[model samples]
Target: MFDEFRAKRVLSRCVDLRKEIYNLPSDLNKLRKTDPKKYNDIKIKLRDIV
Candidate 1:
């Protein structure tokens, strides 16, 4: 039972990672053009998340 729960949690996190990776580029670009500080923050977060 514990193993099953762990597997589901990991799978959900994998989906989250996929979404983050898909959206990251456009997000980074928008931030870069307007908010350099926020862009750097996002880059660090991406490195940690992905």
Candidate 2:
């Protein structure tokens, strides 16, 4: 039972991470247009996260 629960949790976390990664490009674009200075830092952070 514990193993099954852990698997479910991991799968859900992976799905959430995938969603974030997929949305990253749009976020970068918006940041670049709005705050060019911070864009590079965010891009690097997002790269590390992925």
Q: Estimated TM-score per prediction?
A: 0.50, 0.48
Clashes of 2: 0
Estimate the TM-score for candidate 2: 0.48
Q: Which candidate has the highest lDDT of all?
A: 1
Per-residue lDDT for 43 in model 1?
75
Q: Write the per-residue lDDT of candidate 2 for residues 1-50, one digit (tens) a residue.
A: 56998888878877866776676666667879988877776566557655
lDDT of 2: 0.72
- Which ranges in model 2 have alpha carbons more than 4 Å from their true place? 26-50
**Prediction 1 TM-score vs. true:** 0.50
Report, for all candidates in order, the number of backbone clashes.
Answer: 0, 0
Global lDDT scores for all candidate models? 0.76, 0.72
